[model samples]
Target: MSRGARFTERLDLLWLGATVGVGLLGLRLIHMQVVRNQHYSELAERQRTQVIAQAAPRGRVYDRNGDIVATNQPAFSLIFLPGKAQDPARLAGLADSLARELHRDRGELFERLLEAAREETAIHLAENLPLKTMFKLSELKTLYPGVDLIVEARRHYPYGAFAGHLLGYMGKIDRRQWQRLKGKGYRVDSWVGRSGVESRYEDVLRGVDGEIRMEVDAQGRLRRRLDEVPWQVGGNVLLTIDSRIQRAVEEGLRASPSGTGAAVALDPRTGEVLALASTPDFDPNLLLLPEWDSEKQAVASLPEFNRAVQGTYAPGSTFKIIMDAALLQESVVRLDERVFCPGFFQVGNRAFKCWEKKGHKWVDFLASLAHSCDTYYYSMGLRMKGPTIERYEKLFGLGRKTGLDLPGERSGNVFGPEARKARKRGWYDGDTANLSIGQGELLATPIQMALVAATVANKGTLWKPRFVKRLERPGRPPEDILSEPVGRVDLRPEVWDKVQEAMVGVVKGGTGQRVNIPGLVVGGKTGTSQNNLGDDHAWFIAWAARPGEVPSLALAVLIQHGGHGSSAAGPVARKAIEAAFDLASAKGHEAPAEGAM
Candidate 1:
């Protein structure tokens, strides 16, 4: 119990305390390395490894005859890996060099490089780089530690701006879309179809991405594709469109003074859209480029509006076709019964003037439709009022969606009793008169007009118009194919014959004479719808051959701000019809049965 004995005891206690501390530290290390190993490993993996998305090539789109309209081409992209870089200055220098080579501002490149050097992990330096530029960048890879060249697939339209609206375009994924599609495998760099068929068939056209697990060193260089899973290419789309006829329609539309217009041609038998053209089309390639001024100008120059499916115009005299059909169906107006036209007719407090201010003294239904006698139909529309006309309009696919596969399809404005009431406008006799001639409150898209034409051409049956013929998926079984059926609407035979004959006469002796193609029986109706909002919309709806033709083609043309249907739209329709006939002749297919005009 002396001082020496006390010192030795203290040393023993200190040694024991030290041993206990070391044992505790060893147990803690085991717990962290073993029990919590996965958590830390995951955190390390998250920090060191980044999953960069590789975009799958979108499917190619083809025409009816297997002509390629839309396809994918190889693109080079510049990517930056922040984790691979050591010095920020080196990264900045590399970015500056790239900026100089690509003709970009050095400050912008420096800012981007600084951002990329952060913990963001993956950053895109540039996208859709040309192959030559990408190869040059690859050669200079040693100068840029983190920068790398990536081969990507980009959407390409073979026909440039042709059928652009129908084909649509793709754009980079935005914040909203990214948030919505993040877990669903969509990445920020992913391109999505923003409009038209591209938007509508996005799911079908977006191919599945493949993945490869590669072993990399601390420097992050790939060793091999470990257990690689191949990606699936997008499906192929076969359109019902005839490129030849589509080109002709586009050329004719472009030739007109009104640069904005749309033309849709369909097969009466199958409701296949032969040609769908929209004027003022912007090239999809331009949208993908860096030239903003060129892009704006290109879009501005063309109407960029799809007039055929989206352009809504007053039917004008063309509504006579519907009225005539409804009258014949209801037996309200006899086909041979004569109605006197004194240039204008008085309905309620309004006196609606006919197209021919100098009236035809007396005219029957056939002559009325041929001459587009407004007074005759104005009287008839009064008899067939409200629900009666609405029924016919619905049957003709007006005021409703055509269910076309393309996106942004409008149901069009068809004012019913409720709609009229909502608008606070009472349905007056004058309204009926105007409606009879397709003027008052009646608006129809060019596609709707084409449908009406098809109904008349097919006698009584109305077929649902379709643009997409078939979808071909890669590596998938054919049994999984999706095919839309040909829809038909039934009508009385007599009603069909009388309407058909009148439509035929419209082309032969009436306003559509300009559209008559040689060696082909063309039945058509011309419409100059009044647009007080702007210049009148010119329209022409027609179909080739009689009811019996198996592949009967129907068409409708709309000219924006064009003065008259005959002058603006008729010539476009004529060119398209001529092209179709020429195609038939070239293929040795029998020309549509010739019917005298």
Candidate 2:
């Protein structure tokens, strides 16, 4: 009970209490470092750093000869940063100023800023800012704090709308698109390929985005760069399309009566798409602008339809080639057999009229094909009784998608026995006759028709049509895509021989004379198909050089509202064939242009 002993015990108790408190603090520190370290670290980063995505340049699209089809250029955008804005109320005023400067709806831009503010993210007010606008914005920086200006890469189509449909366009990513692409590093504001080749080859064309980490103070003012990650350049896409021949085809279609249609020319042996043209096309450059949607919607014919691969039109008399091929394949008709036509043929109390009001008195099988005699086709069709024409159609790459390497390709519709059953109707002689003449339930795209011409010219070998020839990445070996063969038609060479002879006669002495090019020995068929539409769609399919000559090229043309194939589409096909010959002779054929592809 001594006073000194009591004082020593009290001192020891105080020391022990202090030691326990110190130990507990150390344990809490360890727990934070071990269990909640990442969480705290991320919180710290979110508070002090801003992650800015640096867009990687997209790959360029090139023609066969390395001509530029699509590329990228530096562009500026006026941005609104809600976090950096001095006053949230000032966003409306800033939006109005930007709208006035950029010629946009002031109220809509204001609403967009408010929506972005609620989401706590930056919003782009205007894109593709001109130098003058950038300079003006720079001068007014004092008036608008947090009105950020950023650099971006916007798509540039050097050829404008030359291959617009195939080239496609880029647009702001929506929630649905972002959901699909977010896992692949696509941000909410990312621009994605919405259509065409841009959409089909998005993975190949989209470059890896770089990231910049910026340090900021409590007030959200940028201090300095904390880290940076450089981006990987996108790979290049070299298409089989030839711009020279493509231009010629476009010009030729422009000169046509309808001034709106599609043309596709391919190498019969390789299925390389030499030229694909859809007239009435709008410039892709316009698609990048704010007014693009309205401008495009104003056009009566949607240019984005890409009629070459997407349009489903009645093949018209051009389908006679397939009908005859069926006759030869089924052994139902002989080349020497004769059928009489007196302008019209009667089937089940109904009559199908020929192009000629007073038809030729009598014509053999070859003559039938040469003159596109409707009555002869009507008679031949009535004999088949089943899906003979449909079977022939499948053999010649019709009644289905030609498998062209473009988006939005349609598998053309044709009524076979199965199709008739599906439609709850029985196949009739009249139906057979109508289908035989390419009138009734037959629908085909220009690419399909072109493939048919190519199949015939390839001596029954059907090759899958291809647009892209190779893939090229800078500082890397190019990836070449050789020609792909879909399948070969197993008909006798003599069948094609007879068909070729008749097609040549079509150009030499019949309806397809307009497509006859000197020294080329062209073989072609003209088609004027009827529809409920005001005028029939004119169609022509031709091969340059003669059959048995390993034809260099084959083409198909369609003119919407055009009256006759021979006059409306024939000349365009002829001109496109000529252009192909010229492009072949050019040195660019052997090698790409300098700084190209």
**Per-residue lDDT for 1-597 in model 1, tens only?**
999999999999999999999999999999999989999897676445555567788888889899999898888888776554457677668767787667777888787777755664556777777666677778656665456777778889978988888888888888999899878778766789888778888877888875544443344444344555667788887888899998998898889868788888988767788888887777887777642334534554555467777778787777778888889889898877999999888886778887777786799989888777888887887777866887777777888878776766677778545568888867766666667777767788888888888777766566667788787777765322233434445668878888878988887777777765556777778888788888888878888863356337788888888867777887788888778776432222222312111
Worst 10 residues of 1 by lDDT: 588-597
Which runs in model 2 stand beyond 4 Å of their true positions? 1-49, 81-85, 103-123, 214-227, 291-303, 416-418, 473-477, 546-548, 583-597
lDDT of 2 by residue, 1-597 (tens): 799999999999999999999999999998899878999887766666667677788899999998889899989877654453345567767776776676678888778877865654545666776687788876545576445677888888987878778788887789998998899999877878888878888888889888877775544456688999987768889998888778888988889998989999998878999998887887777777654245544642454678888888989889888887778878989888999999899987998887777886799987787778888988888897557677777778777788777768899987677788988988778888888888888889999999889888878888889999998776779889988898888888888888888898887777877766666777889897686968888899988864346798889999988878887887788678778776232211111111100
TM-score to true structure, per model: 0.86, 0.85
Query: Per-residue lDDT for 87 in model 1?
Result: 74
RMSD over all Cα atoms, model 2: 6.8
Give the TM-score comparing model 1 with the true structure, all chains together.
Answer: 0.86
- Residue-pair clashes per candidate, as listed? 2, 0
Candidate 1, residue 331: the lDDT equals: 88
lDDT of each model, Cα atoms only?
A: 0.75, 0.79
Error of 2 at 209 (Å): 1.3
**Clashing residue pairs, backbone N/CA/C < 3 A, model 2:** none
